[model samples]
Every structure is written in structure tokens, then in C-alpha cells.
Target: MAPPGCPAVAPVGKWKVIGHLQLLCLLALAQPGGPAWPCPALCQCFGNMTVFCSEEGLRNIPEEIPPSTTQLFFVETALASVPSRAFTNIAGSSHLTTLAFLGSSLEALGEAAFAGLPALRVLEISTSQLTALPGEALHGLTNLSTLSVKFSPIETLETGLFNSTPRLETLHLQGNEMESLPSDIFHPLRSLKTLTLSQNHLAELPGEVLAPLGSLQVLKLSDNNLTCLPPGFFLPLVQLQELFLDGNALMELPPGAFSRLTSLKGLHLQHNALRGLLPSVFAAQTNLTSLYLDNNRLTELPERLFHGTPSLSVLSVANNQLQALPARLFRKSPCLTLIVLSHNRLSRLPAGVFQGLPALTKLLLSHNNLTALPRDAFANLTSLEVLDLAHNQLATLPEGIFDSNIILFNVALKSNPWACDCHLAHMADWLQHTDALLNLQTLCRSPAYLKGLSLPTVKKEQLVCLPGPGSSRCRAEGLEPSGEPGTLPQCTYQDPVGAIHLACDPDACQQLSLHLPGQHFSENWTLGSGCGTVRVHITVHIEQDKAQPGGEAVLP
Candidate 1:
């Protein structure tokens, strides 16, 4: 009376034993087009060679899975221990390739746990309780190319641990408690290309630890306790393209540290205690494009330091103690697009420093003690788009300094003691026409009359350059008040209602006055009339602003 493929059952107590068969029929009907292959009672077997057994109550690997399953996910379960025969019955007859056992209570993988997974290519065991990789945990997984065991408390990786995985290309052991690596730990990983050992307590490494990995392309050793790097440490990594050495305690690097890295493209040496670098350390990295040397104590660099690296496009030497830069330091680097030299103690920049950088786009030179600039300092930056000159000792900028660059759009002129005198006429004119936005307010520092006032709102005529009362430029401008009291440079003037006389004498301060009538308005016309009075009087005008602290006056 049972279904066609269902086995017959004997009757019990004169009643047919069809209860178990009914349960099987219900599960069969849940499958698509009726179950052709036996599916696990605790898992969902998809038709595309995949099996997922992540149920909370199911503590063991399903024995009855589709034999062709290639991808198996045992996620978010309470399976405490995966014994040696855990995957034997399910993966033995199948061609399993990718297996992920994530976020489970998996504490230990018994020896030979992966014995039957010969075709396994990727295995990930993250967010689990695995503390160690047993000797034969990956016994027969010869074809495994990627193994990631992250977010676990794995402390040490013993030697010969990965002897069975010869074809492994990627290994990630980040965020672990590894303090050291055995000398021959990675000896069998001949084909490994990427190895990340970040967030560890590695203080030093043996010279020959990485000598066997000739095919490695990327290596991350950041966030460690390394205070120094051994000589010839990177001599074997000829094919490496990216090297990260940030977040360490390295104080300096020996010469020829990167001499053999000809194909390197990106080098990160930021966030270290490096105080200096030899010019020859990076002389051989010809293909390197990006270099980060920020957040260090470097005080100086060789003049021709980056001359050999013609392919470099971006470089940052910010947040250092550099006081000066040699002239034409970046002359040979034509491909440079961005340069950051902010937060340094640089007081001056030699002329023609950026002459050969034809492709330069952005230059950040803010937060320094530069008081003046050379006339042609920015003459060669034709393609510069953004220039940050804020928070410096700059009181005046050279005229026509940014004339050559027409593509410039944004410039920072804030936090500087700009003198709003005649010297700034050309710059003010340029600022008025350019499309650059003054996101910050620029204030004047000199010419007592313009102090504390925004530079952009000051008029051109108000920028009149009046030399000090004792300066030679004042005498040249016919303002030398020499003779006594009223016997000074004589002048005569007349208006429709009255005549006026003026003199550039030492004591003329009390006798000089001019007025225009407004009903009852009057200006005391007190003059001795002793010096030569005018026959054909000429009219003169002067204006006074009482709001000025000293009641300043201007004559036209």
C-alpha cells in the first residue's frame, strides 16, 4: 500500500504502519517536481549542486545530500565539533569545491576532517571558536587555493602546517593573536600571491622567512610591533606590486631596502616613527606610482631623491619637520599630478622648484612660516587647479604669479597677514576676475587704515601707497614739509564763494582746513595771510573721516 519507491512496512496492532511513509510523502511533495534525489531532512538541497545545512537544532553534517553538491554552507549553527567523519559521507561521492562554515560554535576540526574534499578550492571558517588548525585538519585538500581563517584566537602557526596545500594562492590570517611566524611556515606555499599578517605582535622576522615565496605579489605587514626591517628583506619579492608597511614602529630603513623591487607600483610607509630615508633606498623602484610618507619625523630629503622615479604620480610628505626643500627637487618627475607638503616647518621655497612637473594639478603648501615668495615661484605650474596658501606668514604675493594658469578654479587665501596696500593691487585685480572662490575671509595686516578689513571689499583707489612721513619715497612724491610754520610749499585756490591757500609746512596742521557749505555748516578759515597770497586763486579739496581712530584725512 506504500508509494512506488517507498519500502513496504508491516502492520502493528492490526493497524497499517503508514505514518512514517506519510511523512516521507510530505517531504517529497515539498521538492520541485517531486524529489528525484534524497535530500537531507535538516537541509535544503538546491538543484544547482549546492547544499545549506545551517539549522540551529541540526548538530551534525547531513548524511543524505545531493551527491553532486559543489558548494556547501554550514552557517549560523550550534555544531560544536566537526569530527573526522563529519563531511565524509556527504562529500565523498560529491565534487565539493567551496565550503564555508561561518558563525558557528565550531570549536575544533578533528584530524582528517577534510579528508574527502579533494576538489575543494575555497574554505572559509570565520567568526567561529576555532583556536587551532589541527595537524591534518586540511589533510586531503590539495586543490584548495584560498583559505581565510579570520576573527579567531589562533595564536601560533606551526611549521609544516600547510604542507598539503601546495597550490594555495591566497591566505588571510588577519585579526589573530599571532606573535611570530616559524621560519619554514610558508615553505610549501610556493604559488602564494597574497599573504596578510596584519594586527599581530610580530616584532621581527627571520631573513629567510619569505625567501621561498618568489611568486608573491602583495604582502601586508601593517599594525605590528616591528621597530626595524632586516636588510635584504624585500630582495626576493621581485614581482611584488603593492607593499603596505604602515602602522608600525619602524624608526628608519637601511639602504637598498627596496632596490630589487622593480615592478612595485604602490608603497605605503605612513604612520611610522621614521625620521630619515637614504636617497638610494627608493632609487630602484622605477615603476612605483604612489608613495605615502606622512605622519613622520623626517626633517629633510635629498635633492635628487625622487629623480629616478619618473613614473610617480602622487606623493605626500605632509606632517613632517622639514624646514626647507632643495631647488628643482622635483624637476625630472614630469608625471606628477598631486603633491602635498602641508604641516611642515618650511619657511621658503627655492625658485623653479616645480619647473619640470608639467602635469602637476594640485599643490598644497599651507600651514608653514613662509614670509615671502620668489617672483617666479609659481611660474611653471601651468596646469595647477587648486592652490592652498593658508595659515602662513605671507603678507604679499608676487604679481602675475598665477597668470599662466588659466585652468585654476579654487584657491585658499585665508589665515594670512595680507597687506592691503598698493603692492596687492595686481593680486586684488586678479582675484576679482578669476573664477576661484574665496571660501574663507581674507583680512589685511598693514597700512593702519585697512587693518582688520576684508581685502576683497577694499577699493583700488583706497589702496594708495603712501610712504611713511620720513621715507625717501615720500620726498620723491612732493610731500617733503621742510620750512618752518607757514613758509612751506605754497598753493592758492578759489571757489565760487571764497578763495583758499595751502602750504606743506611743519606747523600747517592747525592752519589747513577746507569746507563745503550745507545750510549752517562752517569750517574755521583761520590763516595768517603772511606768505604769498594768490592773485588768481585755484580751488583745492580735502576730505576727513571722523570715524577713523586718528581722524585721518586724504587729499586729492
Candidate 2:
């Protein structure tokens, strides 16, 4: 006999024992504590949920699903079509919330495939061969919050694919073959906060496509082929905090491209072909903290270009064509901490260029054409720690150039023309003593005799002093006291037209003072012979200070 609450089986001759055994098995399955019931032909069971055994061999979803099953995952399966009623029995269960169809051979999502999934909150169909999304495929998913359809061969995102997901907050459609996006594709998702469309073929963003998203916080549009941004492109996203536009072909930003993004903090515009920066490009975004403009063609920048960004901390303008910077370029950026201006054409820097940046800690000025620097160029940058001036044409530098900046830790001055001369004596002294200074091999670039010699190897003897009487004093003292054979300088006093007198002191310690006419002292007085001599017919000027007290003394 069949047990109570168990379905009954019909009788047959010689099959009665087999039928009774089957009835006992059905009775065991009907009990709450019994073993799980055996699954159908193309399915397997784990507790209440069923896993279909035909995933590899099946081309469509199974027609039947257990009543207790909630979540279904078909990962890397080969389901080419989800026919009608494929999920009919599973839709009756209201507990299903998550569904993932990753790396599938699904080329299209049929209409009403997910019609009854009202409690679904998360759905991911990434890394598939899907080329198009049909409308009404997800019509009943009202509680969906996160939907990711990335890394697919999808070329078109038809409207109403997300028509039922009204409360969605995050949508990721990145890494696709999308060349254009429909304007009203995101119209149904009013509460969306984050959208990622990176790594696409978008040439320009349509203005109205983002006009409905007022609560959006983060938008990533990087790695595209966008040449220019349209006006009011970001007008609706007032609360946006992060915007990424790197790896594009943006040559210039339109006037009001960022007029509405007042709360933006991080902006990435690097790896583009931007030739110039307009003053009003970021006029509205004042709270920016990090800005990347590297690998561009910015030849020069305006003085007040970064005036509106009060909270800016990091700025990178490296690998550009900046010939020179305005004196007041960084005057308004008091909170700036790091600045990178390396690999430019900066031949000279104006005095007090970094005077206003009181909090600046690091500065990179390498790979420039700076032949010389002013005395007090970095006088006001007291908080600077690392300064790199390597690979330049700096032949000379002023004394006490880095004296006022006591907090400096590392100073790189290598690979420069460094003209080693008396003018650089103080620099050599500072280089020897400054604990923070490095690269002492910096040598002279001019005066061919001193080339390739290290600064420390150069001494006071190797340095050539200027030509003057003081420089010839040592050589003159080395000569012999005897007169030459052809020279006639042995005479003590001689006057052809008048009487000349001579005097001598017997004591070798005696002193003598001579007076001339208008010239204070004659060149012949250096002979120290206690006599006065004159050259052939050279006229002289007599001043009262040089006149002798006694008129009887003859003067030369």
C-alpha cells in the first residue's frame, strides 16, 4: 500500500513487488527528513536547487525547475537560445535575486527571457559573444541595483534593455565595440550614480545623454577616440567627484566643458594630444586635488591658469613643449605640494617664480636649457625638500644660491656645462660641505683646459688667476739681480736738460718717500735705488699733494 500523502502506483502482474518498492521510495521522498528526491533526466539536485546536467550538450534552458530554486548560474555554457517557457517553473519562485550568464555563447537575449524576475537585484552577463540586446528581455526586474555587461562583442545597446530596472545605481558597459550611444539609453534609470563607458570608440559625448543624470558621482570616459568635448557635456552632473578622460585625442577643451562639475576632485587628462590649455577650461572646478596633464603639447601656460583650484595638491605637466613659465604661474596655488615640470624647454626662470608657493615640497625642473640661475631664485621656497636640476646647460651659479632654503635635502646638479672658474669658487665650497648635495662630478663646460675634471679635483692652484701686477709679483721676484748684457738700467739718476740729484741711506732698514709733479708717484720709483729717473720725453701732471716741501729738491 502507498503511504499517506504519497501518490499511489497502479498494479501489474509480476511487477507488483517492483511497484511496491517504488511506492516506498516515493513515501521516503515525501517525508521532510528523508533523503533528497532523485532529479529529472537532464538535471541534478543539491538540497532544493537543481543543476541541469545538459549544460554542455544543451542548446537551450531546461523547461522545468524545482519550486524551491532561487538562483541560476550558467557560466561559460553554450546556450544559443532561451526558448519560451524555458524558465517558466522557476519564475513562480519569488526568492530569486542574482543571475549570472558569464562567458556564454549567447549572441542575443530573447524577448521576455527574464520577464518574471521582480526580486532580481544583481545581473552580470559579461565576456560573452552578445552583439545586441533585445527590448523587454528584462522587463520585470524592478529591484535591480547593479548590472554589468562588460567585455562583450556588443555593438549596439538598444533602448529599453534597462526599462524595468528603475532603481538601478551602478551600470558598467565598458570594453565593448560601441561607437555611439543612444541619448535615451539611460533615461529609464533615474537613480543611477555610477557609469563606466571606458575603452570605447566614442568620438564625442552627446550633451543630452548625460543631462538626465543629476545624481551621478563618478563617470569614466577614458581610453576613447574623443577629439573635443562639447559644451554642457557635464552640466547635469553637479555632484561629480571623479572624471577620467585619459588616453584620448583631445586637442583642446571647449570653454564650458567643466562648468557644472563644481565638486570634482580628481581629473585625469593625460596621454592626449592637448596643445594648449585655455584659462577658463577648469573655471568651475575649484575643489580639484589631483590633475594630470602629462604627455601633451602645452608650449606655455597662463599666469592665472590654476587660480580657481584652491585645493590642488598634485600637478603634472611633464613631457611637454613648455619653453618658459610666467613669473606668477604658481602664485595662486598656495596649497600645492608637488609640481612636475620636467622635460621642457625652460631656458631661464624669473626671480621669485616660486615665491608664492609656500607649501611646495617637491619640484622637478630637469632636462631644460637653463644656462644660469638667479641668486635668489628659490629664496622663498623654504619647504622644498627634493629639487632636480640635472641635464641642463647651467655653466655658472650664484653664491648662497641655496642658502636660504635650509630644509632642502637632495639637490641634483649633474650633467650641466658648469663653467669651472673663480666665479664658481663658492659653489665648489658649498658642494664640499653641503650634506644634502650630491653628484660632485659636475665639471666645467668652457675653458677647454678644465673639461672632464671633477669639481673636487680642482684646487686654487689649477684655477688661473687674472692678469695683473699682483699676479706677476712672484715671477718678478724669481729673476736674478744682475743686469742683462744689452740692458742699460745701471744708472742711478740722469737729467739731460737740468741738474739731477741722488741720495743713499747706509742702513739697509732706512725708508724713502718720493714725490712727482702731477702724477702722485712715478713708475720708476719701484726701482728702490734711492734715486729718481725719467723715461725719454713723456709729459707729466703735477698736483699740489706731490710737491716737495723744499723748492731746492729736483723732481722727475
Tell me the tens digit of each residue's lDDT in model 2 across 4-64.
2212222325734543224433543453432454454444444555233325555666554
Q: Candidates' TM-scores?
A: 0.76, 0.67
Local distance difference test values of all predictions, in order: 0.73, 0.68
> In candidate 1, residue 155 scores what lDDT?
77
Give the Å shift of residue 486 in candidate 1.
30
Worst 10 contiguous positions by lDDT, candidate 2: 472-481
Q: By summed lDDT, which 10 consecutive residues of candidate 1 come out lowest?
A: 471-480
Error of 1 at 289 (Å): 0.7
Model 2 spans with C-alpha error above 4 angstroms? 1-106, 115-119, 420-556
Q: Which candidate is the best by TM-score?
A: 1
Model 2 accuracy (lDDT, Cα): 0.68
